[model samples]
Target: MRRLLSTTLGQILAIIGCSSVATFLLFIVLLSYFGSPPAPPWPWQNAYRVAGLVESLRGAPQDVRNTIVAAVRRPDLSVRLTSSPSACSRQTLDTHDFDAALRAELPGITDLAVRACTSHKPGETIQVLVPLDGQTLEILTDRTSGEPGRFTGPFYSALIFLCVGVAAMSAWAISRVIRPLRQLSEQADAFGREMSIAPIEEHGPLEVRRAAHAFNLMQERIMHSVQNRTRMLAAISHDLRTPLTRMRLHIETHRTDIVPDKLIQNIDIMQSMITSALAFLASDTDRETREWLDLGALISTLCDEYAEGGAAIRYDGPEQIRFFCRPEAIRRVLTNLVDNALHFGRTVTVSAKVLDGAIQVDVSDDGPGIPEDRLRDVIEPFVRLDHARNDRPGSMGLGLSIVKEIVQAHNGTLRLINRHPSGLTARVSFS
Candidate 1:
């Protein structure tokens, strides 16, 4: 049952079954309390039976009437013939809603007398009465069942056949609907753990086919982006190396302390760029296992380390905020955000806390923040804002992209917002 309920077809069938039972119960309630009892078997079966007996006994001789009663009586049914009045024995005060139904069945008859009366034996009953030519016929029958006569053999058969037909149609329709979604989910799971995957087939309803098509396009775009980025990195590596080679050759020919110090700074910048580029292409953070860590302390220690290195960085918020994520990946994200902060701003403030049922960490900097228009673009790969702010060495524009990828892998979001006057806040939030 548990396995059955897990599927869409089973759930729908369960609902139908429950609804059928509810409807049946409602019918029983209406018949028992609020309305009249159901007609027995057919609409006018009892009336017709009594009418047949009346027709046979009309103006018959006394001996003939007795013969007919003996011939027609059943084990549960009895018939009586009399020309006497007051034939009913101890009539009870039961409601007579069925009297109108009896009259309606036999249009030829204008009036009929009927009553409920006690029986000699426990199962005997007063079925009904018939009036004939100067005679009365009383029908007494044994009660067939102690329970209410609500269902018949044909009714049960119909209900079973109806349920089977409905279940078959529902299972077919639901299976057709669930098939594509299940395939899409399986493909997604495989792709997240894999880089190269064949495109998923687009089939099903319009929305499902469209979603599959969009996913295929996204995979192609990502594959293209990776190839383009690798080519760009190779070109950049050669271009930057030519100048460094010449600068080294110059230093060898004419050595000066000042020249070498400035040149070394440029060399450091070049190395930073190369390292960041290679790391971005490798995306090693994707393979890390997730674990719970004290994010608050991690930010605090990172701020103190930067502060010791003469950068104006501070940490705030709680002492411990346990968050589930890849520690190294989160550290990489923090490293990139903080690097951008120190390069552009004079001071950096790193804070972490639980906000709105999510783990939120904000790295704010009082630097010349990114232009409002370019905030979104800065997060994309290889985007540099040279015109918006002063040129920072080794700013290859891959840091935020790496950060975004790592955050997304953890099912988190990275949002860059410019401060009011002159700063930016990088907010990382996840539940």
Candidate 2:
């Protein structure tokens, strides 16, 4: 479950959902502020009062209005008053005058209780509703006379600038955190495919850096263990071959008429087992012995060898097809297949072809094919389809297992399939 949520799409959805909720709350607050009635000392109304003061003092005899307006327009004032009423209505204002105008313009503003502001002059103060429209007071001034709140447009413009800054910073922070996590996930996938996974840089937060360090350590340990095991197996197999060769020479020189034919057959079986085990051990250690091999020639050679030994085997396909692989491993895999086919079907056919940028080798025999249910099960190590079929005594079922292991080591696959015309087919492919 944690893995599922850690996916890129999942993380994106979570971010979008959270941001959407925040945006919705902001929207609701803005909507309620604009749509609902004003509070008792309405803040918006105070804006209108300042507008009225500026209007009333616009051309006064004292000349104070002109002096104040000129001063307010200077850059130091940092205030902007637009000619348009819609622009001016949104300005933030001084709390004192704003509240006085709010109370005066909107006596019923207490019912909304949205927000409040007030303004005073000596002992007298004005509290009136902020004008929602430029001419609303013009329509209501005859019914209930009062000053309205007003504001310069600069206040709202500054707020817009601040919102834009916040949004950009938020995006930058999110990307900084998510980038390292994305790289980590990609490295994990590459590791799964057995490719070289570059170590993640320990440049993020402490937790992320620690995770990358641990992953690098684990990979080093695994590589060391594999190399150690391969070396040990190679040394043991090499040592045993010398003793086995000496034993064979000694046995050949003996003149033992007392020994029955069955005993001689048993000795041959033992030799075959030792040879198979040695071949596997050698292949495991000498993985770098790859060559540009003609696959068709290899198949034909194995078929001809078996035919010379009285096995009914035939080769098919083109005169040549080539690939890069360990020729010894390929030969061992083909030999295993052909031997199994001859034991079961009496006649075996080997073929090779190049298809879909891959080399395919098929070894098939006309015999009682495996049951459909046991097709996959038969390929497992030492899992002979039948424990009872013993035309050859001391037959172990490691042949197919070796074939599978070799093919897999070369980044290939092996499969057992039922042939349409007759028996079972072992199909192997190398890319």
Candidate 3:
């Protein structure tokens, strides 16, 4: 029953069906109590009642007829003797069978006038008048609507029935409207525990569809973020171990404790990795907040810093290229690309450009480019290219993988292409 009621059609039918049956039951109770409305006194019953009253009056003396009428009179009825028939002021009822049934009981009467009192209030008042030996006898009483009272007949019954119908219809309509939202809530509960569930379907009214669409987007983004963080932790750990291993081996080999230039670079590299990872993880913006920055200025500063370190690097393209992006994350991406290029190639040239509505930056190196077959594998985390670049002091094959992740986080794309003759270029583009 719970499963059935959860559906739209089932709820609608149940509501309407229950209300209808309840109304019918109510009507039955009213009928049994008030004895059928509007047409209460059956023709034979009314005929017998009127016939008995008339026969009693006819047999009683003129003086005692008034006493008999008074004794039999009720609040809903009035029986009196009159000298003229028009004194009752009653209209004839349009029931031929009732008139014939009355005649069948009272055959002695030649002039029979059934006068009915029309009332707009509660019970129906019926008047039956007949001519006697030298007087007129009028019997006035209720025919239908037992006991003269308001809210007792078919009118109130119909009103109650109508209210039931309207209530049922309203309930069904509301259920249909909120059905999608209910599903949304259920999906949210299910996905809250395990985000691997498939996205809920977007449907229903326009506003509801928009809400569902937003939920789907949030679900996808949260799942992607979790997976990305998991990968980042594993990859960063693997990368950090490389430097730690080198430091350990150096510590073991040179027992005299002389820190060489290559050993210092590895320490610096490990420190940089831990610092960058902490900053990325602890950032309030989840990753980093995007803001407008001068791409050319950033690249120029980086190249100048590399040059200051006695590394051959140059900056090309426009002097100022303003772009919107996460400053720290994008800086990391560019730094990784430039470091990788410097390790493999003789000199690194960083270029920036704004074409169409997008920003493009390329870090090109004039050295042996990566092989076509290994280009795809080079982007995987902890995947080192089988080339001479692996001989670099602090290279752990994390540069391109880090660059790829950062680029993707910025809603950008990264591509590695072999330059003509003898070079490689790493291109990053964003709109």
TM-score of each: 0.50, 0.43, 0.54
lDDT-based ranking, best first?
1, 3, 2
Query: Candidate 1 vs candidate 2: which has greater TM-score?
Result: 1
Off by over 4 Å in 2: 1-260, 278-286, 387-392
Q: Supply candidate 3's per-residue lDDT for 142.
A: 59
Q: Which stretches of candidate 1 lie over 4 Å from their true place?
A: 1-218, 227-231, 234-242, 245-253, 256-263
How far in Å is the alpha carbon of 331 misplaced in model 1? 1.0
lDDT of 2 by residue, 277-376 (tens): 5554455825568889888888888788888988899999877888788888788888888888888897888888888888888989988788788888
Which candidate number would show the highest TM-score if scored against the true structure?
3
> What would the per-residue lDDT of candidate 3 be over residues 137-165, giving only the tens digit for each residue?
77665554333343456767786768676
lDDT of each: 0.75, 0.60, 0.74
RMSD of 3: 11.6
In candidate 2, position 303 carries an lDDT of 84
What lDDT score goes with residue 431 in model 2?
86
What TM-score does candidate 3 reach?
A: 0.54
